[model samples]
Target: MSHAHPELRTPPALPEGGLRVIPLGGLGEIGRNMTVFEHAGKLLIVDCGVLFPEEHQPGVDVILPDFTSIRDRLDDVVAIVLTHGHEDHIGGVPYLLRERRDIPLVGSRLTLAFIDAKLKEHRIKPVAREVKEGDELSLGPFDCEFLAVNHSIPDALAVAIRTAAGLVLHTGDFKMDQFPLDKRITDLRGFARLGEEGVDLFLTDSTNAEVPGFTTSEGELTPAIDTVFRTAPKRVIVSSFASHVHRIQQVLDAAHLHGRKVAFVGRSMVRNMGIARDLGYLNVPKGLVVDMKVLEKLPADKIAVICTGSQGEPMAALSRMANRDHVIRIEEGDTVLLASSLIPGNENAIYRIINELTRWGANVVHKGNAKVHVSGHASAGELVYCYNIVKPRNVMPVHGEWRHLRSNGDLAVRTGVDPSRVILAEDGVVVDLVGGRAKITGKVPAGNVYVDGQTVGGATEGTLKDRRTLAEEGVITVVAIVDADTGQLAETPDFLARGFVSEEATFDAVVPLIEKALARAAEEGVGSAIQLEQLIARAVGSWANRTYRRSPMIIPVVIDA
Candidate 1:
C-alpha cells in the first residue's frame, strides 16, 4: 500500500513524501471507482463505486474498491464526494459509509438525493451536505467548488478541488449537450474561471476521448423516439438507467403525445419518478403515473411501461417480461424499446433477452430501429475544448478504456498542457505533487474486491484468469473414500461433471472413466489429508482431459476421513 492514483511511471510503492493522488479503481477498467487525494495530513475521496462484472464471474454481484491502503487513516478521509447519480459514481456509498459512518458525503442536490436513497436501501443514512454551482467549502486542507455539467443524468457536477499546489478539476462524467432536457450547456465558463484561478491538475473524463467529434445531445433523442412510438401499433415499453431522468422524461413526453398513460414498471423507475416528481424535475400528469400492478390490467394501446434492465439483468422487469415471468406479458403487437446501449460483456445476454422477447411475439427495438439511447460522455473535440478552457498545469485523464486515456494524454499535449505533465496511470498508481509539479509517484494496494450477494472478499487478477480458464475447460468434482487411520484412501473415487460433455445426453459416461483412473490411486493409499485431496484432484483432472477433451476444475472431497 503505497501510491494510490494510477501513475504510468510509478515504482512498486509510494516514495514516502509529498502530495499524492491515489486512485483505487476506474483506471485499468471502467467501474468500482475510488480515488484518494492526500496532501498534508488531510485526505479526500472522490466517488466510491462498484462494478457489476459479466455473468462469467460465477457468483459475484458487485465489485468495490480495495480499502486496505486507507483503512487505517479512515478518520483522515474528511469527505466522500460524488460526481453524479450514476451507479458507478454512487453505488459504493452505503458500503463505504457503513465503515466510515462519521464522514460527510457531499454532492449536488440530485446526486445527494440519489445517494441518500441508496444508503437507505442498505439501512444506512449518511451525513450529507449539498453541493451547487458557485458554492465553496473548506474542509481540513481541501478547498472545493462545484460546477454544473450536462450528461445523461441530471445535476452532474465537476469538482474543482483546491490544494496548496493548486486546483484539481475533476470532470465528473460530462458531455456538451447544447439542447439538453435541462437545456444547460456544459459549463465551460466555470472551467475557464478555474483556469483563471490556476488549476494545477486536471483529472478529466476519458470515456469518449478516443471518439472524434462532440457527443450527441440528449435533445437529439426526442424526434427519434417520437417517430418510433408515433408509428408503433401497440404499447411502447422503454427501459434505461434509473438516473436517466431526461430519457425517462422523453419517453413520458412521447407517450403523452401518443395518447398513452405512462406506467412505471420497475422499482427504480417508480422510485426515480417519485424523486423527480417531488423535486419538480418530472411533470407527470396526476393520473399518468400508474404503478406496475395497476398498469397490468390496462389495454396494450393505452399504457406505456418504462422500466430498468435494458442490459438484460435477470431481475429487471424487461428480462422477466421477455421470459414470460413478469406480472405483465408482452403480446404479439407490443413494442419493447431497449433504451440503453449494450455494456461490453453484456452483449450476448442482451441479445438473448431480445431474441426471447421477439420469440414471445413482441418487437424489440434497439439503437438502429428506434431513437432509444445515446452516450453521456464527451468526445475528443470536447475534451480538447475543455483542456483549452481549463488550461491546467497538469492533465491526467480519468474514466474509460486505456485507449481513451492514452488519446487524452496526446490530446492534452497537443492543446498546450505540456507533455511532461500528462500522467497516464493504471489502477493503484499514484501521482505525487512536489514543488507544485505533479508526477507519477508510486503504487498502492488498490484493486477490485469481488462481492458475492452477501459475502465480500478481495479479488486478485489471478481469480479472473482462473475463472476464464475454468469456463472454457469445464469442472469435475471427485468424491473419494479415505480411511481415518494414517489418513489413507480406502476405495475408488466417485466423479461427477457438468459443462464439458461432448454428448449432453451421455454425460454419465464421464463417471466411469474417472472412477477407473482414481481407483488405482485409492488402492495405492494416501499418507496425509493434503495428500489424499491432491491425489484425487490430480487424478480427476487427468481423467477429465483424456476423456472429455478439456481440463475440468478438479474439486476433491474425501469422505469418512
Candidate 2:
C-alpha cells in the first residue's frame, strides 16, 4: 500500500495488553490538539485540531500538533473520531489525513460534510463513515459510540469508547446548551448508563472550566442581535466563526426581524453557510439571504453583512474592510456589531479592528456595552454537572490552559472524584490502565506544529520567548557582509530597527550603536562563518537597551563572499 493510503489496521480482538491513553497536544496548551488511546497495538485518535496563529506568524494558517510520534503508529490508528467542526477540534484533519490516507474518519453528518469540504479544499478525499447519536461501531479492537452533545455547532458528540480495559468518555467541545438554537442536548440517559455500566476514564472539555456556571446558549444572543438590527439607524456588520451555524442562524433571523437582507462575505463564511443551509443546519427564507456583491448593489442601510474573522485576522473580511481592502467597506453611520468574543490571545487583534471601525465613524458592539456572543462550553456549574453525571473512576482534563486544567481538576476532586483520580496530564504524558485500574504510565515528546502556508513545521517555544522579549525591548536587524576566507569585514554594517523608537530623529540612535557593534566584530577577526556571525550578533544586541528604550530583534545577517 502507498504511504499515502494510510490505513489504521484494526485487528478484531483486543489483544492481551493494558490500555494506554496519551495526550499529544491540547493538554498543557490550548490548540493543535490530539489525543491517542492505545490498547495493546490498536490505536484510536480523538479530535485532530490546530491552534490559530499568533501575532508573529504573518502567513501561517493554524498551529497543529506534531504527528511525528503517531506517524509510525499510523497503521495502529483504527479510527479518527471527531466531536465537532471547530478548527481546534478538526482543523488538523486535512493535514493528518493527507499523510495517513487509510484511516477511516468518523463523525456526524454535519461534521463529516464540513470535513469533506475542508478535505476537498486540499484536493484530498478522506474516507469518512457518517456517525450520529446512539450510533455504535466496532473498529479493529475498540468499540466506539457517538452521543450527540450541544455546542456552537451541530453534530457535536461526547464519545464513549469501550475498550478491553474500560470505557473512556471523550467529550469534545461542549457545554450544557439546554435551550440551544439547535435544540440539541447531551444524552443524559446515555451518560447515566455509562456511569452505571462503569467508566474508567473521562476526558472532558475544559475550555470554559474556569468560568462560574452553565454556558449561555446561542439562543440567548438572538434577541440582542435582533434589537441591534431592528433599532440600528444605519448599516450592520457582524462577525463570527464560519462554522457556527447556530450563531449564523441568529444573525439571519435578526436580519429578517430588522427587515434587512443578510449578506455573507469571506470565502470560508460563504462556503460554510452554504453547507449548513443545504444540510438543514440553518434555514434562510429564500429571498432574505444573498451575497455581499448583491447586497452591495442595494442600499447599505437595507443590508446586514455577516462575515468571518471575528478574531481580527488581517486578511479576514472584517480586517480587509478595516483597511479599505475588502470589496465592501463599512462607512460612517454603519454599526459594526462584534457578535463574537475575542478569544483570549486574539483580544488585541479584535480590538485593533474595532479601533479601525470606530476610526471610520462606525459604532462597535461588544460585551462592555451589550450582549453579542455567548460561549458554547459549560462553565464551572455545568462542568460540576457533568462530573455528577459521568462519575468516572478517573478524570483527565483536556482542551484548556494549564490554570484552567488545574482548576477543573480541583473541581473534579471537590465533586467527589478522588484527588488521585484527577490527573493533571501534560502533553505526551501517558496514563496506563491495568486490570481496570489506571495510573500515569510514562511521557512522550508531544508539541505544536505551525503550518506556514504549505510548509508545516513544529512551532518553537522560542517564538514565544522572542515575543516576550519584544514586548520589553523590540526588534533590530543588523545586515553585514563577511569574507569567507579571511573572515574580514566587507562593508559597514547596515542597521534596521522597528518598534523601538519614534521619528527619524530617534531612529538614528540605533545606527551609531550598530557602528560600535561592527568595530567590536572587526577587532575580534573571523575564525569561521559561525564565530564571526556570533561576534557581530552579541555586540549589537548587547547595546540595544542603553540606546533604545526596548531591545529589538537583532538580526545580524553575515553574508559570506
How does each model score on lDDT?
0.79, 0.79
In terms of TM-score, which candidate is strongest?
A: 1
In terms of lDDT, the poorest run of 10 residues in model 1 is 1-10
Instruction: Give the per-residue Cα lDDT of candidate 1 at 187.
Output: 84
lDDT of 2 by residue, 1-561 (tens): 001011322223333767888787788677767888887688899889888877765456788877876788788888898888888888899888888787899899988898899998889878789989999999888899889888888889989988778888888888877777777887877888898888888888888888897777777777788888887888898888899888888888888876899888888999999999999989998799876677877876688888887888888999999988877767789998877776768889888888988999899888768988888787999889888988989888888888888888888888899887787877777677777766775566666677766777733567556766777566767677766665555765666766666554554454555456556655676356566666666666666656554456776777876
Q: Write the per-residue lDDT of candidate 1 for residues 103-172, one digit (tens) a residue.
A: 9999888888888877778888778999787788887788888888888888888888887766788988
The TM-score values for the models, in the order shown, are 0.90, 0.87
